[model samples]
Every structure is written in C-alpha cells, then in structure tokens.
Target: MISARERLLNYAILIVFSAAALFPMIGVVAQALQFPDLDAGTFRDAWREGHFGTYLRNSAIVTAVTVACASVLSIMAGYALGVLRLPGSEALFLLFLAGLTVPTEAVVIPLYFDLRTLGLDNTYAGVILPQVAQSVAFGTYWMRAYFRGVPRSLIDAARIDGASSWTTLWRVLVPMGRPAILTMVVLTSMWTWNEFLLPLVILNSDEGLRTAPLGLSFFQGSHQTDYALLTAGALIIAAPVVLLYVFLQRRFIAGMLSGAVKE
Candidate 1:
C-alpha cells in the first residue's frame, strides 16, 4: 500500500532529521581522530598520556553504587506508594513528586555546608548521597508509574500463596517490572557517570577519586586550547553511556512507553 512518493518523503525526512541529530557526534569523533588539529595534543594526550584508566575506574565505581542504591530504594518506595493504603500516603507521595520540581543548584549551598560539618566532603559517600537524593524523586515517579501498571490480581495471587510482603515485592512485582528497572539503571548510570556540578563542589581531592567527567574538566584546564583532545575527552566521558544506550535502547523504549501507556 506504500507509494513511491511517500517513501521518498519519508527518506528525505529521515536524512534531514538524522543528520541534524548526528552532526555533533560526527564532528566530535572527527575532531578526536584528528588529535591536536581538532583541539590540542595535550588535551588528546590526557586520555592517551594521562591516567584515564584510574578516572574510568572511579567513574564506574560511583555509577555502580549510585544505580544500585537508587534502584532498590526506588522500587521499594514506588511499590509502597502504589500499593499500600496507609494514611497520609498522598502527602508522602507528594514529597516524592516535589523532588522533581527541585533544582540542584538551589540545594547545593545547604548541601555543601552540611557535608563540611559532617566531614563527608572529599569522600565517596558525600559525592554519592547527594546524587542519590537528586535521583530518588524521578526514580520514584518512574517506578510508581510502572508498578501501578502491574495487575492487582498478581498481588492477590501472591498473598493467597502465603507470600510475605517483602517476598511478593521481590518474587513477583520486581520480576514483572524488569523493563522499568532497566530504564532506571540506564538513566541512573548515565546521570552518575556524567555528573559534574555536585562532584565539583563535594569533592576536594584528586586522590582516590576523580570521575571521568571531573577529569575532563581538569583535562581541559590543563590542556588550555586543545580541541582535539577535548573531543577525545568527551568521547571518553560519553562512551559508556553511548554503548549502554545502543545495547539497551529496546528496553529503554519499552520501559518509558510502559509508563506512558499505563494509567
């Protein structure tokens, strides 16, 4: 039933749209490959000559911890709000929703002072806790939507089978919501991996911890006007996120669409 003219139009639209979206990435890769010509030898050299191995490892550590903490907490929080009939549930849920409206900058000042007082600054716990807090609201909202879509009949069946509350969540609800969990993992990993502002403020030492993103900034400052290396650093910072998205785009789409298609 497809016409030749319609096909041509579709291809034209795709070419235009895809080109626009791809231009930045195409340019970055080209520049990185060009080395200093694209930016500077020092900048490109930072990834090659500098301690990128350490930066990558630190980033992975922080991202893994953040994602794990956010996923478990979000799943439990969302399940509670979606399924439990406790009093003041609406108020507690609103608190979670409020997290979405909060701007990180607004809280950073207070956060910094608190961490300093508690001697958490320059520590992984300090870097991580704030990121987790920032992510919790969005995570809870996404998870709640997904959990809401799970059939209540499933919960009833689990109860009839004498499954405990925790057992039901783990054995039944969590399994059914794999799509949403994968989506959360992707989102949290990307966010933690690329986070800058909070890390910049909370972290004081370059020793034992320097995220890839933080290192990119340091690389830029040290390299001065090196654009090629800048691109290379960007590639380094972006690689994991890009790879994960490419591999998991299907689950991402399914999770996000699951939220939208449900009530």
Candidate 2:
C-alpha cells in the first residue's frame, strides 16, 4: 500500500502533465472561437471553403478499406506465424518486420512511379493499397504477439472438439482477442486517416481525391493569415480521430495492458 502523501504527489504530477498537454488544445479552440460572440459559423465557413466534405469522404473510404484489409491479412498472417509455427515462419515473420523498418519516404517515390505505371495514380486503390501494406506490417506484429500469448490449453481444447484451424481462429481465438484486434483497428485507422505523404504523392493530380490532411494543408496555404479558420479546419480534420479514441479508450487501454502483461 502507498502512503497518502506519495499518492497525492503522484496525482499532482499527473495533473501537471495533463494540463501541460491540454493547454495548447484549449488555446486552439479558444483561438478558433475568437469572434466576439463565439460564433460557430467559423467551422461552417471552414468546412465549405475547404471543401472538406469531399476530402473527408475520400479519407473515410481509404481508411476503412485499409483497416479492413489490413486487419484480415494481419490476423491470418499472425495466426500462421504465431500459432501454427509454419516452416520458416521465423524468416517470414522477420520479412514482415522488415516492412516496419523501411520508412515510407524511402519507397514512396518509386511506389508512386510503380502505381503510375500500373495506371493506379490519382485513384483510391493507389492510396489505400500502400497504407494497407504499412498497417498490416504493424498489425501482423501486434496480433502475432497476442496470438502467441493465448493459452495453449485453449488450442488443445479446440482441437479436441474437432475445430479446424480456420474455425478455431475465427470462432474461438478471434472472439477472445477482440480487445487486441480493436486496438489494431483504431491505430490503423488513425494512421491511415492522418497519412499526408502517400495521398499527397499518389493523388497529386486529383483534387477531388484529396484526403482531409492534404486538404487541410492546401486550406492552410490559402488561409495563411486566418488563424481562426485555420484552427477550425485543423479541429475538423482531427475531430473524427479524437472521437474515435475517446469512445474506444477503455478497450484500447485494456488491450495495451493485456499485451504488456502477456509479453
């Protein structure tokens, strides 16, 4: 048990750090509402002027498809590597890990040219595919750790009950690993949603296909002196991610804690 004084000190420290982190965000909101009456029309004006509807829709499509494809691929690859222990699985797992090491900047230019050659430039597929690959690399590593930590007894029981590998994975392990999977989904969604470089390069020719972050950059360029509109646009671009984390924070924390304990 901790002493009351120590607990109070810890709380004080946390409060200090939390305030430090929150002040800037609060300031941004205040700056965005700089009008005398705190008008809400700034956000509306930013939305219309920025053409954020199209940008947000494009971001949604890319993020959803990337997360969905990456999650499925990660689960399968992780299961094969973590649970099945397939031949040369370590080599294959290491190969996936290599993907995580290679920075996007290193390959993005070539990737753009490749996509162009394939006639996929300025298209949703071009944007979605690279992010899916990136997400799957991390997701595979994440899910593999989760699967590897699952109780061996559970696998034995499933086998004795005549569950095929696919059935066991989907019916037994997947349900049990919901927290871990959800954590991956949230993370991948955030990364894909925030990705600027990939979309900037891949969709360079298509203004209609610009993601929110890219749109915000161009919006910022045009509204260089308008801090109110700028901050409003920034908040609009960030709101979905913030709302997502707010709603899923509990499960995300649980999954993180569970992973740490298991590992």
Candidate 3:
C-alpha cells in the first residue's frame, strides 16, 4: 500500500486503459463536430444535422422506466433468495441463474412471433419488457450477493420488534441497500440505454419508438459520409453513462464491495 513504484505502475495502467476506452468516444466527437480544423463548429454542425434532441428524449424515457422495473424486481427477488428460507430454495435460485445463460437471440424469434400475435411489436412496452427480463437475471444475482452480506441480526431484531416482512424489507433492508440499489439502477440504465439488438429486433417503426442506440444506426445509415453528425449522435448516446459513473463512482464502488465481500 505504501510503495511509490506500485502506485506509479497503477497510474500508468490506468492511463493506458483510459485512452483505449475513450478513443472511440473521442473519435465520434471529432466526427460529430466535423471540424477537420477541429475548431468551434462542433455544436453548430451537430444541432443542424443530428436528431439528438429526439433521440435523447427517447433514450431517457425507455431507460428510466425499464431501470425502475428492473431495480424493484431485482431487490425483491434478491431478498427472497438471501433471507427467505423457503423449501427447495437452492434449486429455484439455480433457475434464476439459468436464465442468465439463455441467449436473448435464441428467444427473440419466439418473442417476436408472440409479440406480433399480441400487437405489442413496435411498442415501447415491448422493447422494455424483454430487456427487463434479461436484466433481472443478472440484477437478481448481484443484489442477492449484496443482500447476503447484510447482518441477519438486523432482520431478527426487526422481526422481534413486530416488523412484518414487508416492513422489514422497506424500512430497514432497503435503506441499508442504498449502494446496491444505486448500482442496480446504474447497471440497468446503461444496459437498457445502449441496447441496440433488442430494440432493432422488436421495433419496426420510426414513429414513436426508436431508442438512441437504434436511432444512431439510422443516423449512421443516412449520413455515412457525414462523420460529424454520426459522432454527435454517438456522443449523445454515451454522455449520460460517462457522467453517471463519474459522479456516482463512490456508490458504485461501495455497492460492488458490499456484494462481493459478503461474510
């Protein structure tokens, strides 16, 4: 912990990884602003050519709703697994984990046909419903790990105080789970926001349903030569995640630690 040489090496590694991860985003910014001169015209070109406003609003809506659903579902399912001593619980938990292994593509063909039958294809709910299902598997796993770390005495005390299961979960466990909850929110938001394959497969209309990722595809197709607009679209999609991580780094790290370092 006190080695200067080790710290230096770590920083060096960080710089290298940071550059590698940031380049694609930087490249997109360079293209969106389209200043071959790389000057002040970036915003002007982006606003003129990109439908960033619409895409931004759409991404916000879908990401918010789906994440809300995923976080709620994960927290409840995770608590049930971590503390509830129901019969055959281990086998049922395995079932949830098994859902993690099933590829979304394998299910998409059946999903599409079913959605079409229900007239849900191209609907906002259709796009979000499948993503919620996918996110729940991983979310439940992570939240379960977090919940397992919480002291059982806390639950016992709550129960002794005449707290019902629902009261204990909401009033005690949920508050203690702030870090894990935030982590769930961030993960689900990013996954849903960046999701392209699902939206592309489920949605066929440009009318009321195009996620930012899917919209970016449309932008790229229409303006293949217009690197500036494409770059702007890319930035529009990426900015929120970057800002979220930067601002919530503490909570993210804390949540991850709570989940992984269970006693």
RMSD of each: 3.8, 2.5, 2.8
Q: Over the full model, what C-alpha lDDT does candidate 3 score relative to the true structure?
A: 0.81
lDDT by residue (tens digit), candidate 3, 1-263 = 55999999999998999899889878776555555643347545664556677777877888888888888898888889887857887787899899999988789989988988998998888888888888888988888887788888999999999999889989999998898888778878878888888888888775457777787788788888766556655666788888998999899888776667543
When 1 and 3 are scored with TM-score, the better candidate is 3
Q: Rank the candidates by lDDT, best first.
A: 2, 1, 3
**Pairwise lDDT winner, candidates 1 and 2:** 2
Provide the lDDT at 253 for model 3.
Answer: 80
Q: After superposition, how far is residue 51 of candidate 1 from its true place, in Å?
A: 2.1
lDDT of 2 by residue, 56-82 (tens): 999999999999999999999999999
Model 3's number of clashes is: 3
Ranking by TM-score: 2, 3, 1
- Candidate 2: TM-score? 0.91
| Collision pairs in model 3 | 31-228, 32-228, 35-38
Best by TM-score: 2
User: lDDT for each of the candidates?
Assistant: 0.83, 0.92, 0.81
Better of 1 and 2 by TM-score: 2
Top-scoring candidate (lDDT): 2
Candidate scoring better on lDDT of 1 and 3? 1
Q: How well is each residue in 1-263 modelled by candidate 1, as lDDT tens digits?
A: 88999999999998999899779879878766776465455545756754677888888988888889988899898888888746887799899999989888899889989999999988888889988887888888888888777888988999999999899999998888898889888988888898988888888664558788887788778877756566667877778888999999999989877777466
